[model samples]
Target: MKTKILFLLSIIVLGTTSTLKAQKLKKFGSSIEKKIGPKTIKVPYTDVVSYLGYAAPGNEDEVKDGKKFYYIYVWVPAVAPELGVRMMSPVGKAKTKNPIKSEAYTKNAKSKDYFDTYITLERSDIISADNISQDAVDSANWVILERNDDSGEMPKQPSGSSYNSLLRYKSDINDPLKALTVGLYRIGFTTYKTGEVKGTFLAEVAAPVKLPGVVMAKTIADLKAGMSK
Candidate 1:
């Protein structure tokens, strides 16, 4: 009888686990559909303008000099682009100026009007664009931005500008999403600089395109699993 009881308990646990996994995937599917697709949101136009700058990892010098900082663009569309009305920041910044072949990147990024060349505006802000840019109508990979101030101490050190751009974008876009819907996304970060670089990551996305909670959980799980293995 004890063995039979143990078997029954095992069956119950399996049933429960299976049910939970199905629910999780269902939730993930619903969330992904919302996020991985195109969408829009309502935001103070000022905040939208800030999204134009790319994400930064909040700077001591920026704060010291009083340059409002930002980067990292995530479109957690409340009702989404067609679903509802929302303001959009239309340009994307690039770590390199390759996509717009006609535009050339100048030697002095610090001294010149960088945005005029490297940064571009996309007609479309959707993921299929392959790169991020300044405008919504362009490619997904073109992250179009310039230092808020050319003179302030460099943000997130000199090497990690793209990463900072991603960060700023993510932080800026995420804030408005907290208010509504099962808002969805297809989020990522990549960066560029003027010169040839190796062993230098222009930028990297923080990971997991959907909910921050999901990203955090997966991160923790990956960490523990890595430590154990």
Candidate 2:
């Protein structure tokens, strides 16, 4: 009788631990939808590029509406029908594939700090790859295509809230400015509320089609340099 009681207690404890571990590993990425007869289901993207970055003090690109902003420039080499962008802060034990890391991120990979992520996908007027000079980038007009403050699909933050950001923008062929043409784009990120944004983050950009030769950089000069290669 005593042995049976001990065995039952161990099974219950193991089941509880497994449940908690599974809950902690619930992470969602960008996805599309497919129809199977009378039902529709979402499918994750095949091509995903991840970037791990760190936002330190006094390293913001600009400040708007009393909030500090940072940007990651991306060069789209081909036209795509849809694009997806998402960001999560404090990048805790998350597994990523071949993620690009910045200098700050490499230096602070072990830092235990993060922030509430707010993100936007913007398209610039510079369309041609040959015209991606610094002068053109400086004079280019950028238009926001999508913005996300809190995403339920994202995993919960340390604060137990889904404050991460995710957005999917479909190209509008009717509108030239809104179309996803071969051009320059950027991922702008900041905090949802007015406060300092300091932490390690994982940001990803995905597309339904294969986007070869896509370049991502931390600044305009870096983006231009990548395009020149």
Candidate 3:
């Protein structure tokens, strides 16, 4: 009888632990609340673009400050009052719903390897989509809008650390150099600690307004092609 009671207690403890873990993990997106007189209303993003990507061996796009970085090119079709970016690594069993998957990700989706993810949102000076070329991207004046390391709002990493990344950047209409206008942008990702960043990652770009025609790609050429379409 005592053994049966212990087994039941173990089950109850496990169920409680799982419930606590779920509570600690926040959703992938963000929301804002407005208090209208007496009632508070939650407003979620109208448009969210998600990408499922995998960073494999020798797949680093660039190296900055001695850290290897991978980039997901973004083309903003319209002006956005605010832009939110977030990244989760070792995607685990997180809810993807329907995300645009890259070839690399599809090929290695079953791999058990994952990593700690750090991310940045950067906007380039090339405002016109027609001028988004390899040379243009290389020479454009790039501004780092936001950088995030370990976000408390994301799911905890395998090491039980809140090492995911999230950032919200509001447009500065007065500052032409830092405004989030219709232009080419990119999400830069790497590891917070100086080491390899091989793993599957889920990234999302969201806007409060319904900004249509926004597109993203893993390469400049692919982004240009997506823009043309």
Q: RMSD, each candidate, Å?
A: 20.6, 4.7, 3.3
Report how far off residue 185 is in candidate 3 (Å): 0.3
Candidate with the larger lDDT of 1 and 3:
3
Q: Specify the poorest-scoring 10-residue window by lDDT in model 2.
A: 20-29
Off by over 4 Å in 1: 1-124, 127-194, 202-229
Q: Over the stretch 147-177, how does candidate 3's per-residue lDDT look in tens digits?
A: 9998788877666678888898888899987
The residue ranges of model 3 lying beyond 4 angstroms of the native Cα positions read 1-25, 28-33, 40-42
TM-score of 3: 0.87
Rank by TM-score, highest first.
3, 2, 1
Q: To one decimal, what is the Cα RMSD in angstroms of model 2 from the true structure?
A: 4.7
Candidate 3 residue 21 Cα shift, in angstroms, is 4.9
Candidate 1 per-residue lDDT, tens place, 12-111, comes to 9987665343222100011112333476432311111111122223321112123331222333322222111111111222222221111111222222
Candidate with the larger TM-score of 2 and 3 = 3
Give one digit per residue, the lDDT tens place, for model 2 in 1-229: 9999999999999876653432242334345688999998776566787888999769998787888999999999899888999888888777887888888899999888889999999999988877877678668899999999998877777766778888999899999989999999999999988788999999888888889888888887777776678
